[model samples]
Target: MPRTLRASDTVISGNPSPACTEPVDGEQAEQPVLGGAPSSASLDTLIQHLVPTADYYPENAYIFTFLLSSRLFIEPRELLARVCQLCIEQQQLDEPGLDKVRVRKFGPKLLQLLAEWTETFPRDLQEESTIWLLKDVVGSLARCEEAYCLRLHQVLQALHQKLAALGPGPESLLGADRPISYRTQPQASIHRELLCICSDPYRLAQQLTHMELVWLRHIGPEEFVQAFVNKDPLASTKPCFDEKTKNLEAYMRWFNRLCFLVATEVCMLSKKKRRAQVIEFFIEVARECFNIGNFNSLMAIVSSMNMRPVSRLKKTWAKVKTAKLFILEHQMDPTGNFCNYRTALRGAAHRSLTAHSTEKIVIPFFSLLIKDIYFLHEGCANRLPNGHVNFEKFLELVKQVGEFITWKQVECPFEQDPSITHYLCTAPVFSEDGLYLASYESESPENHTEKQRWKSLRSSILGKT
Candidate 1:
């Protein structure tokens, strides 16, 4: 890639200094477009236009993560996209093998902020927003000191309680002219419809490919704390922290989306009989994924089933056939440190070795491996007591990261049909409010008080019902 972002000069003065980007004056720069994250040229312009004397290691990006998490922005999603893109660009420029993380320094600071947020229970932000910010902080701090593990667990427990109170959110489900009754539909018809809407494995692989490139990336030396910071001219190949944080954010979002779709689809059935059909539909979805050798979606689908909202539906689960569900869950078993998933992944890798180039398979497990590497990162130091590179520990982590990259080279030969993409993406997404409503309605259909019943009946007539 052509050089675009300027390198920040490191003086090793042991004092904070200002950082700036050298302007890239090029003919390719053009007016910003109407949509999407900031244009590349616009990003360049914005960076250069900043005040000249700002502090180098400022907490702007870290602070932005909190604000972004709160979703108070006019366009929260777009804002996040813009910032992440900027960070990715800077990350690419920091290459040359420093192998250090730029933002890991913010982990402890972010944790402090989260602790305060939890304690004070900031009233200005909605509970849902605080919950999401807590998740973001937790994701970023996975590689924090081992001693903080208990603290982190406590934080999660508190967040979970807060979420139960918050419900899904204030927004209700959107109106559909004709709410399809999955219960009334025959299993075969439902299966046929699902077959039509099934995601193209190739397109799914492409998404994984995009994530793997950015997520599995290594960072540089300047990104690390002073203890691990080596100044040897040849000692500059450490990994950056941005890649891990971004990857974690992306991975969790992706998995949660799949989970959301699964839970929402089942909950939205509105009829008790069809709930079983939803479970069966997903079971087949997982089965077909296995047949196609797409481990990524299989993990996602299975994980979705295991979420509390879905698991709490004991009546629904009792109606589901356990054979396929058991096998699939066993396949992804996290026991003994995911021995089964690792074995399955390796077998899938070996099987795809000789498959026709046009029919090649891609297996990407987003959650497990990333979490494993995070454990590795936290378990050992990258440098020894004398500040020498602990290549042994480093190499082990590198081996795991390298597998995602290497396996990614496998070709996703099938061209994605745009129609298939649209069909699969058409599933209605639920917010916090929707999930809570669905869970309550499913769990307690007849438990409403007489007055509550009349109100619900009235609301139902208006579609809010």
Candidate 2:
């Protein structure tokens, strides 16, 4: 750890000039130690660059630690111990229960290097601080008899002994409790916010579209498929599953769930008039989504209404006008792999080229974009049999991805509307997806006869009374 003067280029904390000595021979023998190895200062600088700074979110800290672990040349113990300790300590400051998930995000690679590759750890590996790092990994990996379990078991025992020697075990804290004041009490008054916002479908659509954009902004385009694909396509093009890819999948599920829930609420309403009103409201919402180029929510709204639970509500349908609804449905028809949607999206994109302040493409329907990405994934090989890259195929995918990226660049026209935000965020309790689909499947004669039998029985009883 101490800096010694081997050559002139000894890097210190502050700027220091290299020592200059007069040459003895005809030519200087001290020809600047020609590239033998990087100095300690250079290695430290590399680590500094690779490691995440203090401002990094706790969730990403493990990844920084993961990269640090891959450096086999370094003194892996002291540095790695500090990283683990800081991650656990920082995560505990916010949500203590989330520490396990946070640490596990670094993956099994962290443990593999520490247990198998670390030849000579620092003398302080027996220290309680260092042992706790091993224990955290043990808890995260749930390793009972894996390759690293023997070493980890000994480390855990040492840590426990050190803790016992210090004092009694600390008292456990009580679990978090939800308070009564959090719930809103019911009242017989008009919801002025909803009444005002419901009439302006454009405003409502913009708000919903904005929410989608907010979620989308968190995901980088590269990060979406980066984790799903290989580092070098020519080496091996097998799909690799990872944490970020899981996040992308979950994001799609949320969109689908949100769509279905809204329609379920509309269908499950008790009053036919209010229910009819909500249907018309959602219909206008669909139209607004189409107009604003937010086809994601547009598709969501149309599909939600088409869900049989909403569709079989014949009474509600009878009162509703289906002109706009029919138009939207025809556009989303899946017969040609939803090519109709592809054309509509292209047209909407063309209209958006003018870049007016009044209109913005808040959220482009990335469903088609994702579909294109899937085709790109499966349609062509990344490399040809001759070992050259399939550049044509690769470029085609890149072009599609480029268009997808460019589509999101349209200037947003509207500011946040709190009235619409409140409406979209809050929703009534709804049954599961399976329950709704089951309701739809039971609409045949056997179920209809059962329903009619119960109705006639009720009628007979009322007549007798």
Candidate 3:
């Protein structure tokens, strides 16, 4: 039998458990069944499982799993308040004769549950209002039982320190500190030595991998939840995870920037020979990304190369070898809903799961992962027709989001190349219109319609200048 953390196991003071430790399929992990209700219990029934009775506390694993994914249906603060209220009500704290008896019975367990929450996902309590509510709840408990006051204060202090440590440091990325528009600096001001410094495709791939890992690390699971939640027209106030969603958007902008950068590199070259070399170079880089299991960059490179501006260069295409590019395209092909890439991603994930070194990493095509999560969220109702929390749906969300959390934790084994990194980040990339103009300049229009487009593009581009 697989050993799971039991209710008696304290979540505080030992080595930290992973964000999730639920048993996989074909395994029987113990689940909390409040009031002997089945897994299909209502949300109110599930919340009761969290309140400790005289003889029972919920399992540590169940608590962690629930708290991690609960945001899909309820806000953390609201949940915390509800749980605390339930505890007070269950203990009958207002009753004069039984107050001491109830406190003696349930006070320690209540403190333990609160500590478990704050310790496991302290970020949920980072908001001032949440912390204030927590302190108030704990204070009321403390007033009822003097022995628990110091322990409660200790939990609050430790949580404060953890939140403080999460703040950006002096060396953190400037772009990550705020939500900024994804605008590239003009080509005239950029370092135009171009790809001369980053000639080795493997080195360029390593640098790109490093950059991708850094961006991935800054995003939190809350960002993924909030990204699709606010789409409901009925959402009133901004969700607490709004800033986190900005981080997710910033990562996406990085992907877009990389795509535009690849296109710009191919189109900006004046000669067909140079354009072909750059195309081949990018293809080689994309291949390296594939071998290294960096699918996001691989897709970005493929996408930019397939854009109309770069794809229309027949002369450039004629000069370059196309065999490997075709294979990369096939792997990323949208046909069959990217079944090929999904298979490749699964292989990489398995490799990472068993490997001793971080070299066996699997950074997925993140936007696709987001889309999958969004669809899953949209497809399922937040509550059952019977008004339960939809525990089954929450379990599936845990599995998907948990996989991403595992991927994000792998440290990039590649060393950074500062000059190449600077070049990649600061390189000027043209907008779509500029790309069309660049393509026309390289190869004159083939027909009357094409001629009209080229003339109009030239007039518009010059007018912008």
Candidate 4:
């Protein structure tokens, strides 16, 4: 390996620096065309640019962009190892006289590059191999120059603490620590009991906001970074991938549970008036969630109320008022690509930005946000025709995901109601089939279509029993 790189050598960074001319592992690196446009560069070119030269450092934007997109093809540990190898080879530590001079020139910039990587995506260092490689690199630097020892160790320590904090806590692993009460209550008695306890719609909304904020707060950029990665065939047997995306999965499950809970509450009631009352209660809860900028919960409640079983209860709906529910549905309508919902989200976000109180916070429907990001990622090319990274695309991704980072930081203004939260978390909800069966029982099949459907449901339920 030569100490000085030639200008014609391939480079991913916009600033052309000397690079190794030989194709890494017999793979031909993509060469830049005469025009400024980048052609598709080899993965090795991208990795080489990550190693900072004594006089030059990779731009911050480029560093963030590469680290994010690189993970799609290669694991973080391997990438880190390659970077360490390049840094060492560049130094050419075999010669006694030049060692001190090269280390002195290159050491701080190397530390800076590593610091940027660790700070931006600490989760990447979760693997033991990556951590060991990082320590080795830092140790080598510490040995070369005593001045870097303190800062290098500090970065390492902070990373360990961060990884520790990111580990799942007891509360996350197990639902509410205390045992759920009212487990013994019969199905018939439980519906009425639940109504009496959770009668206050405003209070219910408050408790829901509390839970929503808790989940949102813990979700880091790493989750979104890995959102588009293809699932491994063995992900089910291996817990690693699940742990990486658990906060996202848990939030989604919360949405589903709330939807089923709303449906179960309505269908379980024997009397039309009681069922109508439950419907009205949930409508008000949805309204309150909207007022609190809790669109996620609002959509869950609205979706449940609109479920087939719940919607088929013509008699129950006739008795209930739906003026407020209609407005909520309109705002959440998926028409025109959810233009109404997007407008509402923008307003809430603006209010949050300008408001004096945390109550003005906005939490967008997270699943939709993830969908938007996935499309953004897929829509753009990773490399330009001239062989440079598509840095512009990454900037757009950062802007979108950056807003979420801001939104999650808002403190929930509502006071927690322990009993309401407990009930929300622990109350047993009926499955979809159960909800349909209960719906038919609440109101007998209106005609033959209903009669046949009801019959099939009965047979299925009985057979399962």
The candidate scoring highest on lDDT is 3
Stretches of candidate 3 exceeding 4 Å from the true structure = 1-38, 52-54, 91-121, 140-189, 230-244
* Model 1 regions more than 4 Å off: 1-248, 358-362, 423-426, 443-465
For candidate 4, the 10 contiguous residues with the lowest summed lDDT are: 1-10
lDDT of 4: 0.70
Task: Kindly report which residue pairs in candidate 3 clash with one another.
Answer: none
lDDT of 3 by residue, 1-465 (tens): 001111122111233122122234433323434234234446676777767866778887567557765666678888988887786677766445456666766778877887888765777887888867766656666666776778878888888876675565212342232222112233343337457888889888888888888787767666777665564668743333355476677778788888888888888777899889999999999999999899999988888887888888888999999889888887876655667888999999988878865456788998788766765665565654445565655566767888887887788888888777776676666778778777888888788987888788767756532
User: Considering lDDT, which of the candidate structures 1 and 3 is the better prediction for this target?
Assistant: 3
Residue 176 CA displacement from its true place in model 2, Å: 16
Q: What is the C-alpha lDDT of each candidate?
A: 0.46, 0.49, 0.71, 0.70
lDDT of 2 by residue, 195-270 (tens): 3455777778877776666555434344334434554447454344454344345456556655655665564445
Task: List candidate 2 segments past 4 Å from native.
Answer: 1-199, 230-241, 358-362, 426-429, 433-465
Candidate 2: which pairs clash? none
